[model samples]
Target: MLRFLEVFAKGSQIHVPVGSPLIRKIPIFVDEHDVTAGAMKLIKVLRPAWDTSDVKTKLFTDGTTNKLVGCYVEDSPEDVVLVRVYGHKTELIVDRDNELKSFQVLHANGCAPRLYCTFLNGICYEFMQGDALGTQDVRDPSLRRLIAGEMARIHAIHAHNGCIPKPNLWIKMRRYFSLVATEFTDQASNVRIQQEVPSKAVLEQEMAWMKEHLSTLGSPVVLCHNDLLCKNIIHNEKDGHVRFIDYEYSSYNYQAFDIGNHFNEFAGMAELDYGLYPSREMQMDWLRVYLQAYKLFSQKGEEVSARELETLYVQVNKFALASHFFWGFWALIQAKYSTIDFDFLGYAVLRFNRYFETKPAAMALQIPQ
Candidate 1:
């Protein structure tokens, strides 16, 4: 059994003005275009005594949306902080206030890194020491257990004041749909949208289909990482645990949706290959571990019955379809607004194609009564 421990440092006691209870509202703003310069300024505010000249910086380029830079001194590398500059117009897609609340909640429970402070357009936080799990790294059985356990721990978190959490999926997807531009300003993208993207009417119908069909599956609404891409999982080999990063999409959602979303990510983003999507046997094994950990964390009976596993299996696979539709539309919106150098339209096509390909079988899955 993997034990959840408080390995991360607490949020820094930066006594700045109040924005929220958990975040220090630092008025400084960082530009995504000039990440290095912006990162240096934030680091100075966070660490005034440290020698700015000797500070070494590393730009993490793997992220598709935001700019990430690590600032640290050679002698005190353990004290490194990550500077994350929000991508251009990402606020249209991401709810920044909700993201901060999610980060604070997770950090308090020791499931995430401490959030240092918030800037005008970004955030600075502890740079966790771990390898961001790659496509193949996630396939390892040992790492898979850690990922399952960590996810269960996150799902176990309760909303403040003992209030029940409402599922954000339907409303969020609707908001994304509303934000998606009808026609792109870029000629090439405009043409691609016209030729390849689904009509708004079709998208609306599919959204309704997901809500009507999947809503009755009886999957519990819990805190979800909503976007558990391979890159978002950080595994520390030394600590023997995994920590999930990037809370931009974190919210109360269908528990099976989180697991299914993660399983979909086994295909990866950069070089997407749905062929790598986990097999039934692999999913069963993963779900077994997750159910056990989830039971343990939630203080339920740890023993998982065959029916319990089967029900989750059915729910997760079906919800995987919803994941595809969610991100496919998300990619379409990103294509219109993002300045990132990735094929957002192409990514959208892959997701939509997979959604249709897997629809019949996933919809056919029935929970063992």
Candidate 2:
């Protein structure tokens, strides 16, 4: 299940292969070396645990990103301790804000994983013990509302950054598109990824079309969980609430993009079955709960209308194209550089294909004046 090959450190820069050995080490030598070294460091310095000798750890292999995850089994299993090895950042395509800073903000707001300590190669945090909601759990009306409330709390978090007025849709995507082009150019030099993906011209055309249409949506900019696939939302049966994890892609963006991106996730995870996309009724039901919760948490009582919801409904579906294009082109970059073994090029094609198939109908939606 290891996604990376070799990770070598050279000076301040870490040339981590598709998978880093340090990450793989924790799982392989869970108790003897990996857990003992991590546990002793935590007890003497970070956070003292029940007993280091009794501690046990295991690798979590569900992630596509090559971060190594080791869960500690200790005195109280409910108090989960997770050690996460960092992935290489050779490609800083997006204008990423401080990942650690954003994470602390969410944790302080009581909505993210609780941090324990930060080490050179990895970090440790208290894992929220819960079931990672699947596509079916995501569709349930009550659980959907709970997840909506969590997103509202996240969007309301005020994290100041150098990008004065958060980057607009076009500005952000244009930069990422440029990076994708560079990746394509780089991958073309190698024979493995030479398969025909969407050309630069086609992406530009699609971008132009999206910019023209999305301009009319006029959604307010907010702090968003740029990535909200089902796995990120964990439902804790003990407390009957959902807690969100993974803030690496968190940013200030159109509310529509966040909501649309999440709704798009209803389509199967890992399997790439577009047939699982949600129905209009299901999405509208979700939006009503989302907007209501968002307003409630922000201490605003503005009445949301069925008509207003209708407009947002049209726009979120329209905005969903950005999610597909964003990750689709992103996969091209990963195809060239990622240590993960997944078919990055094939994934890109699926995303772009969804974009084209959905664009015409989405662009044609009628919003009442």
Best by lDDT: 1
**Poorest 10 consecutive residues by lDDT, candidate 2:** 6-15
Model 2, 1-369: lDDT tens per residue? 132221111111111122212211122222222544654555434445456666666667666554545444465667666766554442354332345555666776777776666565555777877888888889898899898888888776655432233534566678778876754565457454445566667788888887887876777677787889988889998889998877667666778899999988888557877677888988888888888877777788847888889988887888899999988866777776776668877887888888889978887887867
lDDT of 1 at 80: 87
Q: Which stretches of candidate 2 lie over 4 Å from their true place?
A: 1-44, 48-51, 90-97, 161-165, 168-171, 183-187, 190-194
How accurate locally, in lDDT, is each candidate?
A: 0.85, 0.69
Q: Write the per-residue lDDT of candidate 1 for residues 1-369, one digit (tens) a residue.
A: 122121111111111123435567788877778888988888788999889999999989998879899999999989988999999989888878778878887877888798999999999999888889888988899989899999999888775344455677887888877777455334444777777877767878899989999999999988889999998988888988889899999877899999999999999998999989999998989999999999999999799999999999999999999999889878988887788899998999889889989999998889888
lDDT, residue 23, model 1: 69
| TM-score (all chains, Cα) for each model | 0.92, 0.82
